[model samples]
Target: MTQHRKRDKNLGLAELVAIALGGMVGGGIFTILGISVSMIGNLTPIAIIIGGLIASLAAYSYVKLGLYYKDEGATYSFFKRTYPKSHFSAAAIGWFIIFGYISTLALYAYTFSSYAISSTEFANDIQIRKMIAIGVIGIFTLINVLSVKGMGKIEDLMVYTKLVILTIIAVVLIQHGSTSFEGFIGDMAMDAKNSSTLSILIVASITFVAYEGFQLVINAVSEMTNPDKNIPRAIYSAIGLAVLIYVVISMGALFAIPSEDIIKNKEFALAAGAGDVLGKMGTDLVILGAILATSSAISGTVFGSSRQMSVVAKDGYLPKWLAIRKKNIPINSIVGMGVMAAILILIGGLELILEFGSITFLLVSLLMAIANYKLRDKTNSSKVLTTFSILGLAIGGVLILYYEFTAKWEQMLAIVVLYAVLALGAWIYSKKNERAKKIT
Candidate 1:
């Protein structure tokens, strides 16, 4: 208890929201912008809003469970504790959530690499982008392994600075608009006239990945004060702010740039669009914003996900070595996640990994909704909303899978293979621990 209290002394509401925003506003918006705009045109902001609503539905359960469990393990801990008898349940959720984080890690690092090279000769070089992604992951992993306090302070600076930069970039793009706001609206109406509602929902489902990191707040429960009040406040506030930022940025991009450019330079779409519309200054600002956003995201993710990985390992859901810590920092887990993310960067492209991350989080959050609904009385979770959350996320998860199957079947196959491997490893450890317990 004293140790836990000591940890909490270093964090407050500001740090907590910073972590949540850092985890969220990373590569998601940058990557999703091109895809969303390509498919939905000017209605991209609507998709982002729908995405945020889905995120809030997901957050409803997480906040309730976080207040009740207050465990650093977060998703894994909440589910495992709620169903203590189910080893498979614990193992699967642990594997899924950890890998989900890895996928987002890959997503953010890839986006960072993309913007980092948008102006260079190497902008189209896949190999160079992968190398840069691995390098950024290495840098953030080291930062996380060094000191928790140091990581928190750096995250605060990164998150706040990026917010300012992004806001400025949005305003500049809006001010330098190539098309009138009314013209953009007319284009959206035409686009919507030809598009189906299902397509819009599918895009929203894909964009849900942009809101993925808000749960990083729950992982910091042990390091926060007033868990009950602050957990909800921070998570809700972060998600709300993320939605607004995403919409404004999308609107700015659409008003200033053509949809064709957004899709053609999809990897570094925003920076490319800004360069064309606002020239070098606009391009540089967008690049800087992307750098800060992805940098803070990588740092916050390494900080929170590593701790959660440590907790899963402690429960025998993963290799015991991953649980090893120094000065309360999950050094081994941080290195492990970084290494895996780097491997993913080498193996998968941005869109493939982005979809996988979205699907994994949707499933995990759906599970969280189920868990919260089961313990609704204890957690004071609203039965109606929790049920809706479950249904919403379930639909979101299925929609992404359906989108992948219809559009990118190969990526879907790879995701399935990846899940199989994770499940097999989880099952082995789970069974091993259970049998050892019986023998003892």
Candidate 2:
């Protein structure tokens, strides 16, 4: 009884919010800032706001389903239970969501490596960055495998501290900016006239991946307290906070740093820009903020997604070996996720990983929205809101694909092939599950 009570109290609302925020705020802003600015120029924050709104739309279904289902498996478990009869649907979503988590893991680790080396001679050293990225993943994977409460405590420290630092960086950059408020607004107006509506919407859709981590709060349902209150509270609070942070930081960057430099530096744009404006002190601050952001993100992603992976494996949608657990922790799944993310870091480039993660999560969230609509009554979900979520998510998904097709067909081809491979794997396991069920 004592042990059970201790387990129940391991995570509270604060920790839950940290996990969600850690996941959302990590490498996302750092990774996408350069790309968004290059595409939309001064209009990046508007796209960010739209992305946040779209994320909120997607979150409705997750919150409702999370409260109703109260399952730690989160996206995979919710979809599985929602359409229990369709094994393929369950298996396919499981595959996509897990890989989506993997891609984001790679993204965060890559961003961490970029900022970690941004001030060093190895700033542009691709091989060294990849090594550092993989190394950090291993470190966090071991921490997660060690203790749940330990990881949560560390995450709270990193997430909250990074938020404070990020806010300071924004204020300093804006104060020391080269452009005044009027000038910035004028630049935005020019960009608005120059950039197309479709371009802005496409950027918004691409930024959806930055909002991908909020649903992670629901994944901690088993570990947290007061699911009825904390689930929605944590998820919504984290998303709102994320939107504010992204906007403030992006505005600061645009005000202080030139667009050409941001485009050139790409992943390390903030750190590079900070060095120019604030010198060593400013650059160091940005690097510190980024490190903490991506570190907590890595820890939170591995923690939540590994548990969900274990759940999926137990359901016979993945290798049964991954279902093994110790002390209520999915050790095998945790290790497997780290290994797979490392492999992705090695094979995929930064942009490919970013785009793939965004598209996959957008698609998975869209499906979750559809599932919520199907069981709206049971979940106490409003039909009007759920329907809107469906339409918004679907449009977001379409916009992203359109951007890929028109702008980078080669990346689009790679993404398509990757989906085909995952589909094949999901199909094979789903059939195996069918046979096992019939025999039973």
Candidate 3:
């Protein structure tokens, strides 16, 4: 009880926002900027704003249900409690959400490696980058295994400090920008005339993963002070801040760098842009910002997702060994998640993991919107808004499938196969757990 009090007292609104922001902003903007710019040029900010709006729509359900149930199991447990008798529903969401976290884990670690080695001669070496990605995951996995308080403090420092560094990068880029606002507007207008609406919407749908980590806040419901008040406040505020940061950074990048450079250096575009314009110092700063961003994301994802994984295990939807906790930490679950993420880093390509994570979260968030609409009366959710959330997320999902089907059928096929395997495992566990519960 004393320990519990200490945990609650140490975390407040600031820490809660930090956790959410740490999760959302990590490696997402850095990775998405090049991709977005390639697809939409100066219109990248429009796609980002659309993604954030979609995120807010999804968050409504999370905030309402988070306040209602307040389970750190978050996506998985919330579905379980909302539909108690449906073991399959619980198991499926459990599998999807945990794997989604794993995919994002791989994404962040890979982004970290990309920026960390951007200045090195080994920049183009894929094998070396994979090694560095796995190494960072190992480092953060150990950090998470040791202590939650330690992780939180480190996360706080990284999130805030990175924000400052990112702001400075944006300002410096804009100040040194060769393009005028009028010229940018002309470029955007020309691009808008040539680019299809479907393309911009597809880019927005692709960026859903960038806003994926804000729900990590809900995973800390037990540790927070006045969760009923803080959960919604932290999640909404973090999303708002993230949208602003992403827009500023995207605009700044476009202002300073040519579209050809962004598309050419797609992987490390920001760093490349900084190198060309801001010289070595600008390049160094972007690298520093990316490293910090991805590092904090790795920490927060491991910290929050491990707890949710443990909760799912406790409910008999996963391996029971993963439920074991020492000092309120899910050691086995944390280790297991790290291993899977590392494996993904080694085997899966970055674009595959990125799209998989984006689609997985969009589907999961869509489910949350449906769940909330079902419980709207109890959660005080507005009918219009909840319905809009459902419509918005559904459209986002369709756009992703359309994009994948047209652009990358191979990756889409692989994602489908992966989901099938996960579904089979979830079904088997759901049946086993149901039988065990009946016997008892």
The candidate that wins on lDDT is 2
> What are the per-model C-alpha RMSD values against the true structure?
1.4, 2.1, 2.0
Better of 2 and 3 by lDDT: 2
- Tens digit per residue, CA lDDT, model 1, 78-179: 999999999987999999999999999999999999999989999989999999999999999998888778888999999999999999888888889888
Off by over 4 Å in 1: 1-8
Candidate order (TM-score) = 2, 1, 3
User: For candidate 1, what is the TM-score?
Assistant: 0.98
Question: Which digits, one per residue and each the tens of the lDDT, describe model 2 over residues 82-201?
Answer: 788999989999999999999999999999999999999999899999999999999999999999999999999999999999999988999998999999999999999999999999
Candidate 3 TM-score to native:
0.98
Clashes of each: 0, 0, 0
lDDT, model 2: 0.93
Residue 316 deviation, candidate 3, in Å?
Answer: 1.1
Evaluate model 2: give its TM-score: 0.98
lDDT of 1: 0.91
